[model samples]
Target: MGSLDVIARALWSALLLCVISFSSPLRAQPEPIELWHGRVKADQPFLDKLFKQFTAETGIPVHLRYIIFKNLKVELIGAAFSNAMPDAIIAPADFLGHYKELKLPAIPDSEMPDTIRPRFLKTVELDGKRYGYPFFYGNNLMMFYNKSLVETPATSWKELRVMKPYYDKRNIELITFSYQEMYWLVPVIGAYGGWPLEGKKPMLNTPAVISAFKFYKGLVDEKLVQSDCNLQCSLLKFEQGKAAFLIDGTWSYKRLEESIGDDLGVAVLPYIDGKPMRPMYSSHVLAFPDYESQGEKQTKLDKLRDFIFRKDVQRQFYDEIGQIPTHKELASLVEHTTDPNRKAHFHQLEHARMMPIEPEMSHVWQSLIRGWERYSMHGFSAEESAVYMQKTVEREIERDTQ
Candidate 1:
């Protein structure tokens, strides 16, 4: 136990410890990527399984946080200001409108697939630079009818007009829809070849817009449509067999199927002035928040986007969630399946116009809806309603500018 013997023993022990640490084949693990999504609250099991696959294949672990869909933008903005934004965010397409202002990076074009944009990626793109890819689209509207009541679906507005009296005689209301809402009204407006906005100005007062209002009024006047129909009311009317036809979005299919059973038939909207009744559509998107485009985080984001959008993944999500595919290859397989109603839905979606994704779209929706309620439910004429819409929207725009 002399001083030299004690020192040698301590040195030998330290050397052995160093060798064991170096030979153990473990190093500092990289930080897990954080992803914020709103859908996990309801789809946690699906997301959990899909995410496990993502991690397994790429070896990039992720932390998924569920923010409420409505609050996602606010949360992301808060995160940005606090310098704690997640590595990525999964939000509805409208939320991406603030990406540039939030300093988020555009997804590299090379990493995006061309098949998706034609159908699903509609409003998510801005100024030719897309910020993200669509995860799923279920926003398009379609015509739902009772096959037992109506032997054949209406092919034109004129046909529906003619068939109304027959259905009325049978004690069935001809048609009904969520007529008070702007999203519901936008489809009819577009079908008549009118849109609510051109850039930032209101295009609510046009020949087509006036015609659409007139058409709506005619449906009410002829007793072919419920005058003040709304979501719950219309669904009730249709489900109870009080209404022969209902205009609803793709999301309403399951409920209708459950309520109406095998007699539930889906159809492309009847034509207007020789054109198909166009519907408004949109989807949720996956995006990155202010990450360097060529950096490590961006590379990981790229891989995630590419991986999630694969045809197999798209099919799996559609099978589980009933989201219509935007992938070219998968779209065919999904729509060509035995589900004729789903095929019809995809057909209508193909022709549907996507709702605008700009921040000003909020003002447009509210202004148009206010005017619509006045015109459709109250006694205001189409002209008077148009004037109100234009003025209200212009005032809102000016206020925003100020």
Candidate 2:
């Protein structure tokens, strides 16, 4: 009788334990920190290496989705509207304000370099809140010259003209930039103290800008710059020793180094009217989206803060991806590197200006290109082109506003 009672009690207790175990929740996996990156698939390995370190250090899982730069803004806008946005986005600084207007919270990172503060502040700050933190910031134009072609790089158009005979003797062009594209024309126009806009209003007809165009026309007239070449053709010419000087951004540093090796050199654009041709700079920044979950936001903020601000991490990006580091302390290291073929782009960056980030800017690119086409292909005089550019920009900008 005692054995039967004992056995029945033991069996009941085992069944109760089985029921409790079945009712309780299974072990839940850690949620991935959702991140959106505009890097292409070819960059997947590098991105994987970058994120692996962050995950290793924090034990936080990260899921990075590839979105190309061209589609980043529109797709992100759609995501914002649909409430399906990522916790963080790695994007060019151009859209910082746009994202801020979308109500993405900007978490302040006092760890950022003071050198980067002004640009970030100018782009993202409103009423004293910064909306983006600096990540890596060096895609601006500089002059790359082949030492074998010229003893020294020309310091001005005047010097370039005088040296033209040497290249001409060798059947080489003195300098062959993408003459038709207006994108790189800023430095030349800015050399004369003119820019495309004056605070959302078009300034294409500024006397300085007109003079800038005439100056280029003179170059074309002198046969110093090729009028018919695109960037690829010009770059090919430079690579083939058919040209000596090329104007391109820091993004080409490694490629040129690979092509020409130690013969390559980088310097600021030549001067005109005592002002250097200061190109506009573009940079990457860490931006956040307003997340519904506080924990997700915190996880993103923590991971980005931990990964981007480290001196070692910045150095790793510089070494591995050839991304110029924005941390002030790393600047000197890059500037002083054994590679004369490369310079810390920041020194030249100091003289450069930030592009207009306002909504009207979306209208300026196509309008200016069209104006240039009218002048070159439709027989508009310099004065006529200047006036046409002014009207077109204003009209397009007005349209954008409406």
Which candidate leads in lDDT? Answer: 1
Question: Against the true structure, what is each candidate's TM-score?
Answer: 0.74, 0.78
Write one digit per residue (lDDT tens) for candidate 2, span 346-399.
567777887766556656666677766776678888788888887888887776
What does each candidate score in C-alpha RMSD? 5.8, 5.3
Q: Which candidate is the best by TM-score?
A: 2
lDDT for every model? 0.78, 0.74
- In the range 364-385, model 1's lDDT, one tens digit per residue, is 8788778878987799999999
lDDT (Cα) of model 2: 0.74
- The clash numbers for all candidates, in the given order, read 0, 0
Name the runs in model 2 displaced over 4 angstroms.
Answer: 1-45, 61-86, 100-103, 106-120, 126-129, 169-171, 227-233, 291-297, 332-347
Clashes of 2: 0
Q: Candidate 1: where are CA atoms >4 Å away?
A: 1-49, 52-87, 101-103, 113-122, 161-173, 199-201, 217-223, 227-229, 236-242, 254-261, 292-303, 332-339, 377-379, 398-402
